[model samples]
Target: MIGKLGQTSRRYRDDARSATSRRLVIGATGVLTALLTVIQIAAMPAGPTPVRHPLAQGSVWDSVYTAAQAARGEATFRKTCAACHGDSLKGIDDAPPLTGTEFHKSWDGNSLSAIFTKINNDMPSDNPGTLSKPQVAEVVAFILQYNAYPAGKADLAASADSLGGIKFLPKP
Candidate 1:
């Protein structure tokens, strides 16, 4: 009877340990599943979603810059760019034309931000990045006008985000 009692006690202890181990495994799995669910939710895109501007379908024919801005840009171009790009912007020696095939083909289907950035950071050859943001924007407006792009109601803002929203398109 004593030996039987001891065996029964040992068996009960073993059963209790197994049940505890099973409970632990279940609890760990629950925690892991919950963590993964949170991660997935966190990774998903949220509200007020970012706007990615699409490429223009036709050309700069659709009004983009303002006439006043273009006029201001023309003045800036004459003062800073005419010496190198020429009065007609037809390129002088190594200076590339700013209104013809090369300019349009290179910028077509791309964002205006590219042109803004290039001119804002590197221009005039002798002096780089000396032009203020607004000046650069004005110069860009003039170039668009020279390319035969129509003027809009508002002036182009000197901002990368705003410029990035405008795409260049091939002429129709």
Candidate 2:
């Protein structure tokens, strides 16, 4: 009986060693294959890159500031700004609305620059100024639409200096 038990123990140890060796072989093969694949990828040729303006800090308003832009802006606002401003752009429980008499009260006498600064500096509730200037302008256009303002031929300026020159006109 003792002889039989000693043989069983030896077999078990041999099996364990063989299993460990097999696992190491598989692991090494996998690492080598991965290394080869990465080398192949790095050897591939690169593609040409597109050109972009240096000071393109954000979006620049162009002649494209149309009804379509306003509509598009509205969609962006609804998805990103609606939670805080409500669907109507009126402030939510703790948030302020984007339009109406209350909105006018907060910004009517202010210049477009002031409005832009407020939005660019402190908007979107969760992530302010994170949006590009073009996105911010689109949002402004949507707010204007809600307040019954007319669309202009050009998009609002995208640059801070240009934005400062714009004045927020009170809706008639």
Candidate 3:
């Protein structure tokens, strides 16, 4: 009888251990699941972001993006804007700076479209009245790129309507 009782007690002990182990496993799984859920929620996309479009659609000058246009704009800026805007586009005397604090103030509460118009109408101080629409657009794009603005799919050349909405992020 005593031996039987001892075996029964051992069985009970084994059962208790199994129950505890199952509870522990369930608790650990719950924790892991909760953590995974949090991570998934955090990684979801949010807010306005650049809609990447191909270069053929537009370019830095055309008011859209096309690898071809950005390339062309780059060349245009080098030929025309490089003299006063500096090789790096930092800008020379009497020419409003294009990056850093000066850039922020020059464009505070302003629209890119307006900026484009100003450049198109009055630039190169020495030869202000002779730029073509596409040429002006290319130079404007170079300035945008210099200001650290990321390229978007659509070129910003057509009109100031869309450009007015995209606000500039001031640099430190």
The best candidate in terms of lDDT:
1
Off by over 4 Å in 3: 1-67
Candidate 1 lDDT by residue in tens digits, 73-152: 99999999899999999999998999788877788887888889988888988898889999999999999999888787
Model 2, residue 168: distance off in Å is 2.5
Q: Rate the local accuracy (lDDT) of all candidates.
A: 0.84, 0.71, 0.67
Error of 2 at 126 (Å): 1.1
- Shift of residue 77 alpha carbon in model 1, Å: 0.5
Model 2 lDDT, full chain set: 0.71
Best candidate (score: TM-score): 1
Per-prediction TM-score: 0.64, 0.58, 0.56
Number of clashes in model 2?
5
Residue pairs in clash, model 2:
59-134, 89-98, 90-97, 91-96, 91-97
Clashing pairs in 1: none
